[model samples]
Target chain A: MWEQIRSNQTRTLVLVVAMGLLLLLVGYFLGEAIFGSGIGGLVVAILIWVVMNLFAYFQGDSMILAISRARKISPDDHPRLYNVVEEMKIASGLPKIPDIYIIDDPSPNAFAVGRDPSRASVAITSGLLERLNRDELQGVMAHEISHIKNRDVLLMTFCSVLLGTIVILAWFGSRMMLFGGARGGRRSSGGGGGYATLIIVAVAILLMILAPIAAQLIYYAISRKREYLADASGALYTRYPEGLASALEKIAGSTQELKTANQAFAPMYIINPFRSKGRAASDLTSTHPPISERVRILRSMAGGASLAAYEKAYQEVRGSGRGVIPPSALVGETPVAARKAEAVPAEPGKVERARETSDLLWKYSNYGLVNCECGTKLRVPPKLRGSSIRCPHCGRVNPLSSRP
Target chain B: MDCPACKGVVVVVEYQRIELDYCTKCYGVWFDAGELSLLAERLDLRGAALDVNQIAALPEKKAAEKARGCPICRKKMKKVTLGSAPEVLVDVCTRGDGLWFDGGEVGQVLGQLKDKGAAADEQGRVIDFLGEVFHVRG
Candidate 1:
């Protein structure tokens, strides 16, 4: 396990340095076009990298939450969700119950973010909460909690930043080469070493075009491996692989787009938020291991929900242990008895369930929930006139504005 | 978000995975453009599918006259009937911001979709898995 962590650390460092060198090289060549020298571009590239890193280190989670329009929720506001989060926190032995956030989007998805467990936050789309029952929700939260415990969140944070910068630098370099290179190219061509200069320029341009893509591939590689580990760890923590496996089914089946999701950050999610159905994991552009493959592995686990069980299932499914779960990261656990069918209640009817779900959301948003005498319940928004509301059910006017 | 019908404070609501704004004062609900479709599709009702394309193709029963301003952008919203049953007349924002349903109207729309969607759930593999895993018998 220690070796696995060490290898991950080494790989992350190598990936970042490789990306940085790509940025520096592309900057140098594009710098040549703009300033007739690579020095200025190299300096700017370094500055951007430093500044972006500083920003990401300090404000990355906040920035991500803000962009996703995720809002913090009080425990009292959504006890059901808060309870689930607290359960995972205890099970994972995380120092603090990570802050919980809710994005308004109707897409079923969830993710965790922070440099470490103490500062971490878990954000789930409203859609996910409405879709998953309590145990399923527990499974999903467990996955994110495992991510926090494993420091995968921190690692991905670093990778995402590096990927962003490399892509930006390459884009800026191409634009500069196109508009600013005519004079520089002409002057270099007039020199005695014209052909050599031309070849250097060609190679620089080619590298600039490919650098961003190369950085993304590396980013995806690291991200994909971490996801499987989180799944395994999460199942171990919950002692219910069925919970997460079932949750994945619900998440994968949803077609709604998470309106606030940015494509680059899709890796942080439990499932690929933007992934279309049936996309193979072997696709270089995939941000997650295939959902079908993952679900199959989770279901295939026998014995207890130990890391060993997960590893064995992974080996059977993937045909090799390779990079799915890092070697030795799995700790043995006493597998609890399989939960009895009657131990968990069947879900309520759709209308009742929907009403309960709406009440949950409304309570968090400070909306008033009142049941009419005619049996119709109303969710009143905080901003509206809290006055007389006619029941669409019985056509009897209910006095709601009487409340101060 | 303000309620389109009663101009009262609106609260957010969710069902399945689809979220909409509901008014406290008038009990009206709002579904952003594409949200209704999203909600319907998420319900995954196979028999009586109420997709966006189906709703768009419905004959304009009510004209665009007296269009209400969009709650988000306040543009004049066009009125359109929902579903094949020609159910509630939803005031749709021309800018595609969302649709406005008077109090109880959302219930009507969802109730119908749910009926159709219910038949489809009989074969849902996920639900079957949940039943097996959780020990729910149907």
Candidate 2:
């Protein structure tokens, strides 16, 4: 494990340095065209780029949060969620507690942002809270905390920014070569080296186009491996690989799409938001290991006392006809089969009605409430409200103001 | 525009010919749903937060108008107001369906409710202290 971590560290460092070098090359080439490559001009352009990127680094959290429509929650507003995050923070030994944010979207996803744990924030969608049980929720939360613990949040952000700059430079180079070069030639009255300049510009454009993409493939490779590392570490942290594995299954099963998501925030999710379902893991372009593969690994981890036993058991479990029960179900005192047999019928229309109510409440609550029985104290799903809820404890449903 | 549910004002900001309606407090957007997608085809549109203000000049008849059923509950929904802010009343379905916020109302309603909760906490503390002095527990 240590050897793998060392290898991963080496790989990530190489990728970051490669990205940096790519950015520098693109910057230099673009700079030479815009401002003749005197030492002073080069310095001035590089300085400006660095200064601007630095500003983005400091304010990036706020800007991203706002753009994503994530709203902040105080501990007073969401005690359970606040407490969960607090516990995770302590367990992970983070210097400061990250702020929590709630997105109204119904997608079962979460992400961490900020330059590091000290400045980080975690955001979860209402759908995630609604769908996941307490243990499953813990598993997912642990995975995100693992990202913070491993400093992947900072690393991914830096990689993304650098990659973005490279892409921009590439685009600028292409646009200039296609249009600007001809104009430049017109201005220079067909100078002897004009065609040579055009060829350089064309080659520069091609390199520029290819550079960022190549850099991003490297970025995704590093990012994907970090996810696998976080998954392993998170299971270690919670002592329950099945918990996260089950959570991932639920996340996979959920059909609700995240409305606020774009390519930029896609990598931060526990599962890739943009992933096409049913694709095989052997396809290397994927930003995440295939869900099936991840679940298989986790189930293997859950099957035995030692990692070797886990591997052996995992192979058997995969090969044998026995389907792995969800970790939560398996962890319960009773066998899941007995529980299934003992399960009560849905009281006629009750299940259907509840499903309907759940959907309606889900959309209206911005997917916030889970089991709001009119006679029960409007039971919301546990955690992640970013606000307080009323109980139907007395069977007297209190009218809540929509204004508030 | 005010959120029909919360009565918080919604603001329309213009960049060129396009207009967007956004709520300051709740951050919920009001468009004809897919209209924004169409608008995004040409313009670089993003949300701009608005500040809440009740439209005092609107007729009281609009205030009296009630939605027929809770959108989520399929049952009657009630309009309730926070004690601290009598002017703002929200129609909470409470039956596990969703609560509606007028286009601009979500923020004010949520903000005022938070303040009301803080006030309630203080009052509860005082009441508990008085109960201790009086030995009121059965």
Candidate 3:
């Protein structure tokens, strides 16, 4: 695990440097095209990159939570979720347990975000809670915690911020070239350096069009690999590949769409948010690998839950290519046997699970509950706190106080 | 969520995990995109009686009432007619956020659905539950 983390950090540095170089190059060309010099554009690019890095380093997690409309919850809000996260925390040997958040959307998905393991947080949708059972929930939580433990969260944060900067700079440059190029063109036409200026402007336009696409491709490539690594680590932590495999199957089978997910935030989710029916074509542009392939890899791990086991399964499933887990991390690794499933009480029915999930969301939304004597539970919103509500089932009038 | 019709604050009333937001002032009910289906499922009415997507995809109706904003997205909702005889006009969010039924419209719409046959018994249960909850009769 330590070796994986170190390698991840090194890769993160290389990614940042590569993206930074791309940004600077784009900036220089755009500056020269627009202002007849590359210095101004390069400075602006550096400034944007630095400012974004600082912002992301300090407030990235909060920003992600805010965008997803996730609310923080203590153990009392959902004991099952908390317990699973705690179990994974201990299993992964993390310094601090990541704060858990719940998004109200009905889509089944989850993601992790933070600067490092100690500062990390995991967010799960209400739909995910409503659908997944104990073992499956543990599987999902373990995957997210693995993301934190392996330092992928930090690397992803920096990469996303850099990607955002590149996209913005490219967009701005293209718009400037379209709307403000006349002045530059006229000036160049009047000078002896007309041909040189025209060539520079043409090159700048081409770069602007290609830069964002290039950055996105790089981001997607890195993100997809990290997902597989996290899955491997998660299985190792839980010592149960079936748990995650089943969870992935459930998530992929769900038809409900996550309302909060957009193109920019799609990569952060466990499954690609904008999923389509055409599997092969979508795989190239998707942030995560195809769900079927991931499930196949997990289900094929015949040995056990060790990194070596996962690597072997991965190679076998992918037809003998280089495996996902780093070679150094698997050196001298003994096969870790998959644990038996934990004994749980009679599993809750679908309706029961839905009720639990909705009850939690209602509580978070500050809906006051009033139980009627006839067995109907009425949830009154805060707006109706001072008013009385009648039971829908039994027609009993329930009085409400201004404050609970 | 604010009532699309009355622009007044709406209170959520939940029973068996099916939540509905209704305005206290206008007594208008708001059924979020999937809540109606949830209610139908609770009542075991499994057919096409409450397919929200189908209802949302219904052609727009030209109504005299002014367009109202959706409580979820705050975008102007379109007027659509649901069911046949005495066609009930309801406000459906263009973005599929929810449907807004004015004062007695919920009962009217369900009453029409019940009259449409086949699932009348199950539909009656939903109507009865809503009537008792909101103190209205279909």
Task: Give me the candidate number with maximum lDDT.
Answer: 3
Which residue pairs show backbone clashes in model 3?
A392-B133
Give me candidate 3's TM-score against the actual structure.
0.85
- For model 3, the local distance difference test gives 0.79
| Runs off by more than 4 Å, candidate 1 | A1-17, A277-281, A321-323, A330-342, A346-353, A363-371, A382-387, A402-404, B1-138
Tell me the lDDT of candidate 1.
Answer: 0.70
lDDT of 3 by residue, A189-270 (tens): 7888888888888888888988888888878878888888889998999999999999999998766678888676676788
Interface RMSD of 1: 13.5
Cα error of candidate 1 at position B48, Å: 4.3
Which lDDT value does model 3 have at A259?
82
Instruction: Provide the clashing-pair count of each candidate structure.
Output: 10, 19, 1
Off by over 4 Å in 2: A1-8, A32-49, A182-190, A193-199, A277-285, A302-404, B1-138
lDDT of 1 at B5: 65
Residues A270-295, candidate 1, lDDT per residue (tens digit)? Answer: 98888565666678788888888889
Ranking by TM-score: 3, 1, 2
- lDDT (10s digit) by residue, model 2, range A329-367: 123222111001122244223223223323333344442
Error of 3 at A200 (Å): 1.5
User: Measured with DockQ on alpha carbons, how good is candidate 2?
Assistant: 0.02
